[model samples]
Target: MEKYINAFTDSLLNTLDYTWRAMTFDVPWYTNFFWGLTAISLLVWLLEIAFPWRKDQSIFRKDFWLDTFYMYFNFFIFAIVISGVYEILGVLFNDLGITAKSFAIIDIASWPMWAQLLVFFIIIDFVQWFTHVLLHRYEFLWQFHKVHHSVKEMGFAAHLRYHWMENIFYKPLKTFGVMILGGFEPEQAYVVHFIAISIGHLNHSNIKITWGPLKYIFNNPVMHLYHHVKALPDGHRHGINFGISLSLWDYIFKTNYVPEDSGTIELGFPGDEEFPKTFWSQITYGFVKPKKKQPSN
Candidate 1:
């Protein structure tokens, strides 16, 4: 018990220190995710300004600052807050003799760096896609996910506006993908990380792009915009376009729904009109059981 407590405290402090270093650019340029995310966001924002799909939407659209705050909050602040739980779990797993290579599905350590990265990207992307489907499929999960669907005006920062609980769901699956590869994480894994971030930012940005024929492979703003639409298809009450970085999953699973490319389509879920707008409320929004509707005679 004491060991686990101590591990949590040490890990929490280390996470904070590492975050500070990244923010101050004390880390290597390539591994500095803080500034890397900022640079990518700025670049995408510029594209949105230059070629906005919604011409009438303001540069500072609705909830722009709110979504921006969510970006940093989810990325750094939430990680810092949850570091202790992860550290405790790691300590417990270590005591159980469980290693990263314990559940090896295939040995990729001998593979070339490019091969390792490609495999890592594909596996993690599919994990995220599956997790996304869960967020929409279950009502309990959808309550937490509604915070993301609350975006009436999508932008680059909106990509990270999801509820913190989503991190709880996603990070573990991604880590499992890493573990399944027999701890074959390459030193250049940051390359795949940055690429995912860039793709996510572009997918939510106002700039319309189908990537031409590559649209079948990569998720784009147009396809993702429909993911935020209020109406679900006749059969897919859960959702559609659940891909994170790859459109291939949606295509293969028959969940792809791109009826039109019109940017004027309305966004948000059915009851989102009553959804919380403030951060505090949103973070705590879905905890309580909602009141059931009374039947009318």
Candidate 2:
């Protein structure tokens, strides 16, 4: 009887895996990634149409298309550039006699699949949250990251409106860190990457979610929306909700802000009031120094 039950559970897991692969067309890695991205984008769009956060009514204008185009453009460009660089680096690392085969933690790929997944996400989120905070506090890094914050409106595509250089620098470090630390194989890393990107996009989405108790565990769209809020003149309402996957760090660090009531809040950079509306302007302005303000006579 025990043997039969074990066999049944194994068969059920295999069946579910088969269904997932079938629905995804069992495509190549790159193709699967793109398709996953498209699927999530479509889901977010449908949610926006069905239940938008803001009732101001002009939120779904031509600006939406423009933002969407910018988002896709950045996503593809970063994917190509970062992947190419990582491939080259990986080859060099292989030639230099460095590999994950020597690492015990990474070799835990032999461990239970669920254990591997848990470790991968925890490590990645730790690195990402620290990196994100560094970008905000550091002036030079903020130049590139500001592009992400420049968005006045919150939506699905708003999450991807980042400078390509940000990815070129940030992604390589992240990939290399994972490879060296636990030696998480590229395929496992890829799966985690897809999940993280999907969740990050959803966090930036304008959809309303009650979340309830889950708010303490996972970051919902409503919580993340507050992170993009423009800073007050006195810098009182500046930084909050710095976590990417889990809200634990934010709460521990006193950065988490759970609003009593959900509502559409003002978003964007406080110092840079004249945010560029055009794609080129937005990307280029970050490179140039802002004009100095003249003191009132």
Candidate 3:
């Protein structure tokens, strides 16, 4: 309960920081991220255009524009939803008289900015890796996550092409984790997110760049591509290669699966099931559950 309260306090602080910064200076931390995302997307898209990992992959490929729409929609919807959540959490915490200034889990303030950033990032990434695995293994959660894997061809934009619920679930939890572990101010969050998103785009990108020895350190194109592969490794009920930015987590857990190649298997899940093709169907997919089966004699 103390940890949760701590997390809530930081959430409140972060929102106020956003509000104050934007109103006073007209540059919220999130706005910095929005522009950073656009620049990174453009750079990656240009690379994809010139030297695509799959040279056969086309710029006008199916759902290409759809992903762009998803990217833009994600920023808008995320800001709105986060603001609403922050307001509710803020009121509650204020009522309790808990605040970021009142408490902190650790004294990272004395640490160098880069060191503080790195430590907090690893902690959050671990939490995210765990959440991602849950989405793959759990039946109800998989319905939302299926939207992400539905993309037949992975691209940089595919990073944000997730069921909106996925964002709802991830963003709050990550913010909470960062808070309880060690409070993150808006400036700190902005720096870490830029690095995380840049790698995420590359991971989903159609680029053939190799990380070489860094493959063991950071999650790269090859490792992440295997994650989206249809087949799970033997004895694995859920998918493998669950790490995002860092390959180390999957390595420590033994969930990382990088074969000679991902093989020539189809993308998305391998089963009788096929996720919805259009945007609307994908968003509302959670409502359409499978019927219960009759008991056997």
The candidate that wins on TM-score is 1
- Model 1, global lDDT: 0.93
Give the alpha carbon lDDT tens digit for every residue of 1-297 in model 2. 454455445555554554357446785654365567777788887777777776563547436777787766776544543443455555566767877544434454566777777777777787677777877777778788888887777788787777766776667556655675556653456677777877777787767774788787778788888778785333434467878877777877777775644655777877657666677776776676655659899
lDDT per residue (tens digit) for residues 220-263 in model 3:
87788888887677877798888878998888888987775432
Cα RMSDs, all models: 2.5, 10.8, 5.9
Q: What is the lDDT of residue 267 in candidate 2?
A: 78
Lowest lDDT block of 10, candidate 2: 76-85
In model 3, what are the clashing residue pairs, if there are any?
A: none
Write out the backbone clash pairs for model 1.
Answer: none
lDDT of 1 by residue, 212-267 (tens): 99999999999999999998889888899999999999999999999989889999
Candidate order (lDDT): 1, 3, 2
- Give candidate 1 misplaced runs (Cα > 4 Å): 289-297
Off by over 4 Å in 3: 1-31, 93-105, 262-264, 271-273, 289-297
**With candidate 3 superimposed using the best TM-score fit, by how many Å does residue 225's alpha carbon deviate from the native?**
0.9
Model 3 scores worst on lDDT over the 10 consecutive residues at 76-85
TM-score to native of every candidate shown: 0.96, 0.77, 0.82
C-alpha local distance difference test of each model: 0.93, 0.69, 0.75
Of the candidates shown, which would achieve the greatest lDDT relative to the real structure?
1
Q: Compared to the true structure, candidate 1 yields what TM-score?
A: 0.96
